[model samples]
Target: MCRWLAYTGNPIHLEAVLFRAKHSLIDQSLHSRLGHTTTNGDGFGIGWYGHPTDIPFRYRCIQPAWSDRNLREAARAIRAPLFVAHVRAATGTPSQETNCHPFRYGRWLFAHNGLVRDYPAVRRDLMLAIAPELFPLIEGSTDSEVMFYLALTFGLERAPVAALERMVGFIEETGRKHGVGEPLNMTVCATDGEQIVAVRYSSEGQSRSLFHSTSFRHLRDLYPDDPRILAAGQNAFLVLSEPLVDLPGWWEAIPESTAVVARGGEIEQYPFTPELA
Candidate 1:
């Protein structure tokens, strides 16, 4: 339903990924090749962690990314070692700033690209599933935000994969109780500034599009003759809804129903399935 990209390992200008890429996130907002909908113009958001760990600078708008000049100017200036950029396509959700993605809680940031099929039908049940302590943290009425808080309620900070598994498990169980089948199509990214974990999964086994860029050192060596390659940092990694470039060895598709962890110069993938039982 939307397009997004997560970058780690580099401390380069935001424009390099948001604008300079051949198929940048901004371009995807106006013309997406992989998203279910070609246009994700409902809204946009970008979140980056600055030098201080206590806070992150975020800019979100209910306007199209291409139509905002101030965002373009800001993109050129802001830089971060880790960041997430998202372009949303509303799934019957209202177009509001609170609904924009990259939802934050403490040092954590999260975003999603999928639907909870007939979310309204199960919204109450899902809301009740969250612990009272975290129920107030939800500011938006989108399933994406619900998923975030559910993870928090279930202990995202203590255990990410397990918390997300519980979230998906609960959603699937609750949806099926209402005669909804395969109600989960989740391609989610969650981070606490120490580790970044991304998952691609759906109850139907066919999930959203996601790809990870080749290692920075590998790309730099391949394009050793290009000086621009040197601008990237040592651990630079990119996880996107679609390939940013057409380089043959520059990208790889994240397998269906898999969880990818990018941390400490290592990228690993594992088969992902939620066990509600």
Candidate 2:
């Protein structure tokens, strides 16, 4: 399991959410409260969309986020309209740079907080399912990276939600064929430099924890004295594996087995089920 945060709103320094929050993602990397492991020191990564290009800039390394000096430096210097950051606690894979989260393809960025159970048993089937053209794009051995390419193979560019559903369905179907009782447990976030889609789901119905912040304007009002909220764009929204701060009414726990789409300051939630196609 792991911890991650996705931010889309006004352009602000990455540190504001990655390091400066009350319980920032960097803090979670070392002392996570809700993750399976308290220390996610395997590795970390950050991806953000900057101007002049639709594609995101990514910085990933197999270093603990809390002690990475370059991460601290970059977080303070870079600002973007949207970004995704992750700290990894390798479930069954080695801690390698390519295995870090916020995996990217073209204009898309993705990260996951859970695993595909019995991945080794089902890995070959899932890998073969990926379109050959897209297969070469997979650079890591983590189930998370495979899931990303699987979604891409299933048409993530055209329909993110549907593609992801199909991806999970494929994993679940393959896992069951290999006798794995529960195949999927994930809180996933994906973005194409515009709209962001997040899903909290599992084959067994015990998905990991996920939270989303209220509108920035509303949060500013709720915590008038908090400079961090004041600095965020009015339309900014944050979705994370856990609450970055303890401000009441500022964070909402997303229901299990749910999909949340956040775009243009509006957030919508819908019941999530694997498409099984």
Candidate 3:
């Protein structure tokens, strides 16, 4: 339903990963090999932190990413240590700027790559559950935005993984109550400037595509002489809806019903479930 990439380490120009990689996020907008659809041109967005405590800067548009002149110029000029880019293919919702991905709130930036089946049928129930404070902040009619606010209402800032787990659990339970099949297929990425938490799950047990890169240090050791790897940080890591390149050992798939947390150079994985109160 969408394509996204999250990068942490090395304050390289956004183009380094958004456009330079062999199969960059820009290219994925038109040639995604692992997403549910090959072309995710509905809309796009990019969010990045200027400093650890600053609210993330974001740009979202209703136009296709490849055709956005501002995005092209900005990609070349903006640089950051951690950021997220997403190209969406709206699932029944209007294709508008607010409906684009990489949604932001406070210091957090979030994007998703799948949907809540029968979202329309359950949209009201889900929205009503969000805390009143966050309810007015939702600016779009997409399931992705709803999911973001849901995480916030459930305490993402204090306990990200658990909040998200509870959100998914609530979705599955709500979906089943509405007799909706294949409740969800979501590969979500979120960052609060310092650390990132990514989740992969689906009620059907088979999720949409998602992968994370090996550390720049490990890649350099493997290819000893690969100069590109030399320019990256020892902790440079990338999480994507699809591999940025065809390089072997460059990426690893996050297991189904699991969440991966990356802070600096340390990464950890935790089992996930689709059931919530």
Candidate 4:
């Protein structure tokens, strides 16, 4: 229903992926090949971490990404070592700026690319599950933001992957209670500035499209003359809802039911499944 990308690596301008990539997020906002909808014009947002702060700065609006001059200028001006950006497609939700993604809490930034099947029927149950302390911060009426709060309530800062598993389990359990057989569909990610934890999973085992870039070191080796790849350095990494470039060697599809943790210097995987007994 939406498209998102997260990057963690050497400091670089936001335009490198948001505007300059072969099939950038801006282009995807108007024409998405992998998203359920062609246009993700309902809204857009970006969150990035910069010098001297573990906290992130967020900018969001209910304007389509392709036509937003503000976004274009910001992308060209801001440089961050880690960032998360999203283009939204309204799916049974309002197009208010509050509903736009890349939601934030303290040092964490999160975004999602899919919906919770039949979310209206189960929204209350899900909302009630969020810790009472975090309930007031729920500014958006989208499942993505709910999921982010649930992760925080379930302990994201201390253990991100386990927190995600707990979040999914709670959603699945809550949905099933409301008779939704296929209740969850998502490819989501959250970052605490230093590390990124992303997951691709659904109750039915079939999830949304997600891929991670090959190591910049290998990419630099493959295209020695490419300035961008060389500039990103060996430690840079990217996880996207779809490949930015059409080339094969640069992107690898993440398999279904997987959680990826990118620690800048390395990428690690763990089998992901809901855990609620």
List per-candidate RMSD values in Å: 1.3, 1.1, 1.1, 1.1
Residue 205 displacement (Å), model 3: 0.6
Model 4 over residues 1-277: C-alpha lDDT tens digits?
8999999888889999999988999988887888889889999999999842568999999989898999999999999889999999988989999999899999998999888989989998888988999999899899889999999999998999999999999999988898999889999999989988889998887888999988888888899998888778889999999899897599989999999999947999999978772
- Candidate 3: pairs in clash: 169-276
lDDT of 1 by residue, 122-183 (tens): 99999998889788888989999999988888888897888888889999999999999788
**C-alpha TM-scores of all predictions:** 0.96, 0.97, 0.97, 0.97
Measured on C-alpha atoms, candidate 2 has an lDDT of 0.90
lDDT of each: 0.87, 0.90, 0.89, 0.90
Candidate 2 residue lDDT tens string, 194-241: 888999999888889999988778777777887777767788889998
Candidate 1 local Cα displacement, residue 42, angstroms: 0.6
The Cα error of candidate 1 at residue 69, in Å, is 1.0
User: Model 2: number of clashes?
Assistant: 0
Provide backbone clash counts, one per model.
2, 0, 1, 0
**What is the number of residue pairs that collide in model 3?**
1
Q: Which portions of model 4 show Cα errors greater than 4 Å?
A: none
Task: List the lowest-lDDT window of 10 residues for candidate 3.
Answer: 224-233
Task: Score candidate 3 by lDDT.
Answer: 0.89
